[model samples]
Every structure is written in C-alpha cells, then in structure tokens.
Target chain A: MVSTSILPLQLDNVSFEVRGVRLIKDMSLSFPAGPRTAIIGPNGAGKSLFLRLCHGLLKPTSGVISWATTEDLNPSDAQAMVFQRPVMLRRSVAANIDYALKLRRIERSERIHRIDQVLGRAGLHRLKSQPARTLSFGEQQKLALARAWALKPQILFLDEPTASLDPAATHAVEEIIDAIHAEGAHIILTTHDLGQARRLSDEVIFLHRGRMLERTPSPEFFTQPRNDLAQAFVRGELLWWNLGKDNRKNKLKQSN
Target chain B: MNEFSKAVAVAFQLVLGLDHQLIEIVSLSLQISVLAVIIAAFIGLPLGAAIALFRFPGRMAIVVFFNAFMGLPPVVVGLITYLLLSRSGTLGTLGLLFTPTAMIIAQVILVTPIIAALTRQLIEDLWIEYEDQLRSLGAGPGRAITALLWDGRFSLTTAILAGFGRASAEVGAVMIVGGNIDHVTRVMTTAIALEVSKGDLALALGLGIVLLTLSVSVNGAAFLINETARRRQS
Candidate 1:
C-alpha cells in the first residue's frame, strides 16, 4: 500500500465520438480517491464508455484526464478493469492470476502467495487447477476479479461485474469487493442495479444520454435526485423500459 | 478374379513387412512436412495475431493478400522456388535447386499464408469478444495477443495440421524443386510419382496407404483437440 490517499482523478471537458456519434459528451468531473464510486445509467447511457475512458482504454476525442498524484504515476500501472462479461485465457484458473503477476515481474513465491489469497478471497481456491473456460459463469467473473485483485491496482474499474451471477455467487462476489475496498483500493464501477449502487457506492455518478447528470453522494442521489431523468430512473420509469428492443416502437413513443 | 483380395494383401504386406523404400519415403515426407509446418506456424501465428489486433496503413490490403494466398497453387510456388534456386538464377550460388531444402522452402511459402489467414480470422473474432476484458486487465498489445493466441490454441493446432496435410500430400511442388533425387529429396509424394511412372504399383500403393493413414490420424487428433476446446469454452 503506497498510502497515496490524496491522489484524485480529474476529467476536463472529456468527449469521445465514434463515427460522428458521441459516446461520451463533453463532461468534466473530479473523483477523489478511496471508497467505491458507482456509475449508474440506463442502457446506452455511456456508463461503460465512461469507465473505459477513465481506464485509458478509449482515447478522448477532446479534453484531458489527469491523475493528480504526487510524484510520477504510470497510468498503466495504476488501474485495472473487469468487464460486464469476463473472459479468461484457455489456461487453468490459477494460471490466469499467475499471468498478471508475471507481466508485472512478480517473483514465483510472492506471486503464488498472492494468488492463494486472491483465489481464497474470491472463493475459488477449490478450483485452482480447473480450466478457466470450464468454470461456471459466476466463477469466471469471480476469477476475473481475483486476477485483477491480485494486481492490487490503485483504482479498479468494473463494468457490471455481478450482472449475470446467481444470488449466492453475487453475494460471494460482493464480499470479495468489500474486502478489496477494505484493503484501500479505490473503485469505480458501472452498474444498472440501483440497490447495488445504494449498498456499495460511497458516491454516485449518474449519467443519462452520454451526459453526466449528477455526481452526488449515494444517499442524496437516491433521496433527492437533481435531474428529472435521475428521479424517473430511480422510480424505475425511465425510457429504457418503454424503449424495449424494437427501435421503431422506442423512437415512435419517445418522439410522441 | 480376386482383385480386392490382392489389394488387401498388398496393403497388409505394406504395413506388416517393413518395406525399406516405403519407410524411407514416409520418414522423409514426415521430416519435410513437419519442419515446414513448424516453421510456418512460428512465422504465421504472430503475423496473424498482428493482422487481427493492430491498426496500420494497408492492413486490409495485407489481409486481403494473405486470404488470396491461402489458395495459392503449390505448383506455381514450386516453379518460382525452382527458378530462384536454379544454377543460372540470382540465388543459384548455393546450387540448392534440387534439394530437400528447396522443397521445404516451397512448402513453407505455400502454407505460411494458409496458417496466417486462418489464424487471423480466428483471432479477429476472439478479439471482438475479449479485447475489452484484456485491456481492462492491464494487458498491453503484446500480452493481449498472447492471451488471444493461448485461448485460440485449438483452432491454431488445426490450422497447423491442415498445413501439414497439404505439405505431406503435395507432389507438384516437392517434385519440381526436390527433383525426386534418390536417397535425398525422395519424399512420399515424389516417390509415389516415380514408382507409378516406373510401373511399380506395389511400392506406390504402399506409399499411398501410409499417406492416407497419416492424414486420417492427423485429422483425428485435430478433431479431438477441437472437441475438447469447444467443450471447455462452453
């Protein structure tokens, strides 16, 4: 633990456009380090895109994002993200963790020690040698978390990490996440689960239609949302449910 | 009256009795094809991975060229190689025109694109599915390719085996470049050609059996690997 508690992230007029369709618009915000920050949005709200930009996976079309940390910080070394649907190399569960540590040039004994701890944390110690692709859906997500957790990233980005898990598995994953936060790793996760956001998030960054609607504390965001969209979203009457899968219906109804 | 019986007896004799010429030809064919496939895989895997993952000028052009080359005529490749290594040509100083080395080179050139193009398609699809996850895990471009390749190893093995099957059965290329020289470049395909030309049906039939059996076994092995990989992925 480097104890760089004062490190915060700044996004200044950030924007990302693909094929002239803006994924994330000109948004400016600062994120204080530590505690879990949840990004909540309806589908297509660019919640995932925002998390990606934060992790430097997608370069901004305009503006800058900087980490205000003392001394030099390698952006590559400072963060890790887990996707909505996890993927693993066609190796054993243990090897996935080992690969991450090896890339960072961690030694064998130390790597093994950390792997044990992470696997145990994720409740995956019993399946260490199992082929990664053979694991159940929830198990794979847990393994993805274990692999990232082993890195001990300064800021962890998660894109709906528990979306597909069963209740028991989801509970187990939440415990691992809580443990990670306890160990002092800052987290920025995107989720559609309002209850999950309320339970785990210290602060909420609410996005709607690629725009940052609010950046309020979780309790305040839920109780007294500043935007109509946020309030409608919290009441579960957002356009997403009305939209459904048929674009024609969605467009016709929303237009009216 | 017993034509089928005779065929069976000949096949049996070819396998049971260690026919010296047949053994030598099979060994040489295996040696050349295995070497060629190994060399091609080493060159092709990374090339294919790069083509799938990277952005560069003319990438689509390069991809199109490789896809076109996958169906390249073995005889044409042999002809070009033969000309290049001939005594009067620029690379003729080494005088390797009718050698096994020339045959290996021909096989490598013929199959490198096959492996690369097939691997590129496989990795391209895998990248779409897993690229975000890879980037999120702190994987650099190199590590991401390594992970994709590792995940797609089963498909890659099948590609390599397909290359081996092509190399082992290719007569036109090896025949032209190796010149079917005895005790040297006389691999199975070229040996079969020579035996048939000489009306030695027994030796040619025997070599045919070996080549057929090898292809079948190689395909069977590839099937097993593919099935296992599919099951794991599911």
Candidate 2:
C-alpha cells in the first residue's frame, strides 16, 4: 500500500504550448486525495495533454505541477499511466509485468509475487505466458494496467482507458480499474464519455478550447453545471457557435 | 548448353564427394565472413542504437553519412585497408597485408555500415512506438535503447545476417587484401575469380553453386525468422 502523504496534486497557473499553439491554458487546480477525478472535454480540448502534463510525461510550458509529497521521494516512482493505446512489449504478458518491476529494481522473488497478484486481479493469470502483443485489445489494456499495478504506484493516470473498447470490454476494463483503485491507488482519468466520467469519477473537470470551464462534483456537474458551456455540453448541444444566441435561448427555456 | 550441363554435373560431384580443396575454400570463406560479422555487430549495434535514441548537434549529418556509407564500395575499403597495412605505411610493422586478418578487416569495414544503417532504421521505428510508455515508466534514454534492442532482437538478427551476406559474397575487398594466396587465404569468391580467369570453368562453377546455395540459405533463414516473429506477435 502507498503512504498517505502523496494525496493531492497542485497545478499553479500551469500552461502547455506546442509550436506556439497553446494546448493547456494557464490554470490553477488542486486534486485532493480519496476521490477519483475525471477530466472530461470535447475533441481537441487537450484532456489527454493535461493528464500527460500532470503525470510529468511532458514538461509544462510554464508554471508548476507539484505533488504534495516528501521531497526525497521521486514522484514518478509513485505514479503510473495506462495510455489510450497501451504499448505492449513484444514479449510474454508475464514478461511485460516483469519488465516494469525490473525497472523499479524490485527483487526477483517479490516480482514473481506481485506479478501473480496483479495478474489474478486483472484476470490475466491464465494468459501470462502468451505474447503480450497477441492479446486482444481489451486484454492488452488489462495487462497494461497490471503492468502498472505491479509497480505498486500510489497514483495511476489512465488516458481514455476504455475509449476503443466495446461495451463488454469496457465494462471489464472498468472493473479492473476499480479493483486497482480499491487497492489504494488514486485514479485520475480523462475521457469524453460523460456516462463513464459520471460512473467512475467522484469529481469532474470540464474543459473547452484549452480552458477549464468547470470543476465540480460529478453529480452536481451533470445536473447543475455552473457555466453556459458546461450546461450546453451536458445537454448535448454544440457550444462553439453563437454563444449569446444559445445562452439567451437556454436561459429562457430554463426559466419556463 | 552441353558445357554448362557438364559443369553442373562436375559441381555436384565435387560437393557430393566432399572434395578437400573445395571444403577448405568454403571453410575459409565462412570463417573470415563470420568473424567480420561478429566484429561489425559488436561495433554497429551500439552505434546504431545510440544514433537512433539520442538527439545531438550533427546527428542528421551522421545519420545521412552512415546511410550513404551503407553502399560503400568494397574495393575502396580494400584499397584503404591495403594502404593502412602495407609495408612503409601506417602500422606496417604488423605485417597484416595479404593475410586473412586483413581480408576480415576489409570485410568489417564494408559490412559495419550496412548493419548500423539497418539497425538505425529498425530501432528508430521501434523507439517511436515505445517512447511514451518507456518515458512514463521512468526509463532514461540508455535504458530505453537497451529495452528496444532486446525487444527488437529478431530484426537485429536479420540485420546481422544481412551483414554476413554482404561480407561472404564480396570478392573485391578480400581479393585485394588477402591476395588469394593458395593454401593460405584463398576463399570461395576469390578462388572462383581466379579459377574463372584461368579457364578452370568446372572448379569456378562448383564454387559458384556453393556460393549461390549459401546466399539462398541465408535469405531463407532470415525469412523464416521473420515469419516466426510475426506469428508470435500476432
């Protein structure tokens, strides 16, 4: 189990720009522990980029991303990510997990123990000897999660963990993710699936055009969004055109 | 047609009977080429992996240079090796000129760039697919390169075999550096060249058959390895 110290992540006016085009606008937000947070936005909203930034895969163009943890502990060691399209090494499923543990310098005996545990949890134990690349997309995602889980990370960042999966596969992946979270890893995910965000996340961060428009509890955000854009998004209406006209219409309709 | 048929018949006889002279030449060719490939792999794999993984000033120039060098002429490599090892030249006291070692060195010079260039291409493609995950896993560049090289083992094996093929088939470099000395440094390609020139068509045709068979076998093995790896991946 992870220590309780690395609970919250603080972003102080963090911005990320690539090739002079800003993708993540200057935004200050804090993610406290104990609740799963989901960053939800439309296409090109930089949700994945924001998750990558928080995971330290990309350096912020400016400002700071700080984890509230001890100075001596390397933040990366305590965090892991499962990419939208998880990259599996061309080796056995078991070897993939072993590779992660080996990187962390985990001892061989303990690695075997952890590998067995995570494979069982992810329901991949029976396929441990199969080549990882040969696994189906859903099983590969579970293996990716299992590989990360083997490291015993305190925080796990998942980027659209079930975006490409079918409904059945998505449900299985979600169950595995929930199992990991139950095992004490903080879950931070980005998705465009409103239902998935609502079902899995405790809080929602709604973004539009590289800017954070709303941050609220998932239940409240879906029902009582604070911003016009969030409300439009919740109602499944496009928010990019003629905000003034749309806003007046929405407001009149709400009053009625 | 009759002469060619007779040559073919004689060649088969030589092979089936295990002629000592023919065996000696084939053994020498294999020895020199295999040793050259070993040396080239030792140098080329790391150099290629480094170039693929790191970004530095002049990296593009180096990559382009090595890519072009993949087609380096064997005779030119032989000429350079000759100049280096000839008496009154640099390190002339070593007396390596006209020796099998000199031929091996020439072959290494010719093959290293091919292996390195191919490895660079294979590793670069792999690194693109692997960079995000590896970086997220806290892998430094060296660790990432090591992991990629290991994962790309089958492809690297093909690259090494490519180097071996180039080394084994080349005659210009070995002939020039090795001098085709009888019972000493004579190899298949050089012997074939000598035999053809001396109008010994039967012997030349025999060696030619052996050389062709070896090339086909090497390529067949590479294809098999690639197919097996693909099946495993799928």
Candidate 3:
C-alpha cells in the first residue's frame, strides 16, 4: 500500500482567542515533512495552545489552517498526539494499544501483532496485561508513546511530554521519542527545557507572549537569537518571578 | 417492648424456616426488580452517555428533565401505568394489567430515570477528562460514549445498584400494577404491605428483614468491586 504524506501544512493568519483574549496571535506558519521541530517558549507563552490548534483539538477563531493532502486521505490515519499528562484508558496496556489500532479499523490479527511488537519494544511486554493506570507515571507515559506508535501516524504532536517527569523518566521518554523520529514520523513538540530543545530539534521556533518572534536553525538560535525576548530567554536572565518569593519571605518575617 | 421482641422472634423463625409463601414472595421480588434493572441499564447507559458526549439543541433541558424525573413519585408513575394498561386504555388489549409483566413495566419506568440521571452526571465529568485524548485518537462522539461508559464501569455499578434499591423498596408502583395477586404476582414489598394491613405483623417483619439483607448484600458487592478497582488504579 502506498502512503501519501499530508505534510507541508499551511496556516495563514491563524489566530486563536479565548473569550476575547487572543492566545495565539495572527500567525502564518508552514510545517513541512522531514525535520524534527521543537517549539520553545516561557510560561504563559501559548506553546500548548499553538500545538492544540495544529493538532485540530481547537479551531482557530480567525484565519485558515489547511493540509496539503492527496485526494483520498484519512486524517486520523495520518496523525496522532501524546498529551503532557498521559491519559491512560481504564484498561490493560495491551488493550490501550489495541484500542487505538481498532479505531483506525486495523484488522484483529494485525492489531494483535502490533500490540505485541510495541509492548516488547517499550520493554513493557512483562506487564502487558496489567491495568495501565496502575503503572507508575513514567510507565504510563511510555505506554502512551507505545500506543501512539501502534497507530503508525505520519505526524506526532507532543505537548510538554517530559515536563513533569524525573530525570530518569525524562530520559526514557526522550529515547522513545527519538525512536519514533527514526521511524520516519514528523515530530513536533513543545518544551521549556533549553537543553532538550537543542538536543532533539533540527529547527527551533521561539515564541513569547503569544507571538512567534523567531524561527532559526538549532545552532544559530542558541548562539544568537534575533529577538530581544528570545535572547533574554536564552541567557536565563528572565528571573523576575523571584518577586513572589521575596514577598512571601517578607510576610513570614512580619508574622514572626 | 415485649410485643416487639415476640415479633422479632417470630420473624427470625419464619426466615430460618423459609415459609413457602415467603419464598415465593422473595423470589418474585428478586425476579421483577432484577429484570427491570437489567432492561433499564441497557437503555439508560448508552442514552446517558450520548447526552454527556454530544451537544445538541436543548441538551441542558433534557438533562434537567432527567434529573428532575429521578425524584419522580412512584405512586404517580403507578397511577399512569395503571391507566395505560387498564381496559380501554392505550395498551389495554394486551391484557398486561394486574400481571407480573405490568409490574415489571412500572418498575422499569421508576428505575430508568434514576439510572439515566446518575450515569449522565458521572459520564459528563469523565468526558471532560478524556475528551482531548479520545479526539486526538480519532474517536468520534459515538465511540467516545462507549469508551467513557466502559472506563466508568465501576462507578456506574453504583448507579445501577441505586436504581435496584429504589425498585425493591418502593411498594406503590408494584401494588397498583401487580394487584398483589396472592401467588401469581406477589413480591416482598407488596406482600409486606398486605400482611401489615391484615394484622399479620410477623410475616411483614420477616419480609422486611429479608429485603434489607438483599439491599445490603447487593450494595456491599458493588462497594467491594469499586474499592478493588480503585486500589488497582483503574
């Protein structure tokens, strides 16, 4: 079977607003196949909202988001997503993987084969029958990745996949991510971890205050970001959040 | 106080002996209520899930309608069913009135709103949690409903049991529809009601005890299932 890619997706003047507050300002962006891209931004910078818009979980309030696809294409078969806090079905690991495959209407034998293959690849075959929610947080994230892989999507979107993970868990998740990228899927993810951004992405999109300020190659963006906010972010000089800490300390002293 | 002790003593003896009439009443009670609940679940679960997962015109109104009807007076429902099944009424020719089938029908009406209303509230909350993930997985509204119900099975079991409790405890509906016919349509609640009026305090007390045991045992089983599922983190 020949697979046609739905890449080179274009968004023109795309803006998303929640109750009159524009979370994603007028943005024109194109996502071409091949490169592993990462969206880097600070807290409240709208990275997750941007990801949701692209993943079609939220519709843009204005402007256009279009996919350049072949005549007969199934959007579901072409893309998948893994949320930051993994959502494990109230079922076994094997069954969770099977459910995604079943939604794509994969045949039973093939679904079983894929379930076994993905579970073994994640080194979770031993706990395949165990309820997924019973697994540790890291294991659940891995199962989320494994389940998405079983779908064999051409594009995978991740929203802060390792944000809450410990170092070891984050490492495991990053490894699975690399494995997915190696299998020829387009990887688009968001993270505030600058080191992880540098390691995983070929291109970096720096966003600040709900606006895309810079798009540059990994090496150049890290060395000398063009925008002032992006530059300050790279230098770790945006530490104004310490005011809250100082205020709390002063309150404690006054109480004493 | 002495009279009360004598009543309790006679009740226990009758229970241990399993009087023929008592057995028949208890068995019929279980049969009607269990069957009614089964039918109610089959309709209520998917209906409730649909209301939770989909949005349409007047959806909130329908939700409010179900919630309000959950407290629907059993006596009113019995009177309505009595009318529909009575001769010259809508379903009159079926001759179902005064039969066990009529009682089952009335109980189904009484139990369905309870099950549906509770399932809707439970599933609506779960949908908020699973919506984004399921949508990303390409599940449409239809599939989402089934997935939510399956995942919420342990909690939904409690809702089903609540309906069963209501069905088994209420007397007005079955008494009206079943006519409390001696052996043919008599159930524990209806029999107890009849026995009390006839001054057979011992039998009424006995059936009351049996009914309480059934309610507690069923609810306890549901609680254990939920507790186990919670520990297993499902």
**lDDT accuracy of residue A183 in candidate 1:** 82
- Per-candidate Cα lDDT values, in order, are 0.85, 0.89, 0.89
- Candidate 2 residues A1-256, lDDT tens each? 5454565889999999999999999989987767898988788888999988998888999999998767567788888999999999988999999988888888999999999999998899999999999999999998999999888888899999998899999998889888888988889999988989998999999988789989999999999999877887787776443457667677647744
Lowest-sum lDDT 10-residue window in model 2 chain A: A239-248
DockQ of 3: 0.67
- Candidate 1 per-residue lDDT over residues B1-234, each given as its tens digit: 375557657866987798787788888899889999999999999999989999899999999999999888989999999889998877899888888889999999998999999999999999888877777666766778888888888778888887888888888999899999998999988888888798766777788888999999988978997897778654
Once model 2 is optimally superposed onto the true structure by TM-score, how far is the C-alpha of residue A219 displaced, in angstroms? Answer: 1.2
DockQ for all candidate structures vs. native? 0.54, 0.75, 0.67
- Deviating ranges (above 4 Å) for candidate 3: A1-3, A240-256
Error of 2 at A12 (Å): 1.6
Which ranges in model 2 have alpha carbons more than 4 Å from their true place?
A1-4, A69-71, A239-256
Which stretches of model 1 miss by more than 4 angstroms? A1-6, A69-72, A239-256, B1-8, B225-234
Docking class of 3: medium
- Which ten contiguous residues of candidate 2 chain B have the minimum total lDDT? B225-234
Pairs with steric clashes in candidate 3: none
What is candidate 3's lDDT per residue for A1-256, written digit by digit as tens? 5448888778999999989999999989999988988999888889999999998999999999888767688665788899999999999899999999988889999999999998888879999999999899999999999999898878899898898899999998999889988998999999989999998899999987689999999899999888766776787856652346566456445543
Q: Report the lDDT of model 3 for residue A148.
A: 90
**Which order, best to worst by DockQ?**
2, 3, 1
For model 1 the local lDDT of residue B99 reads: 84
Best by DockQ: 2
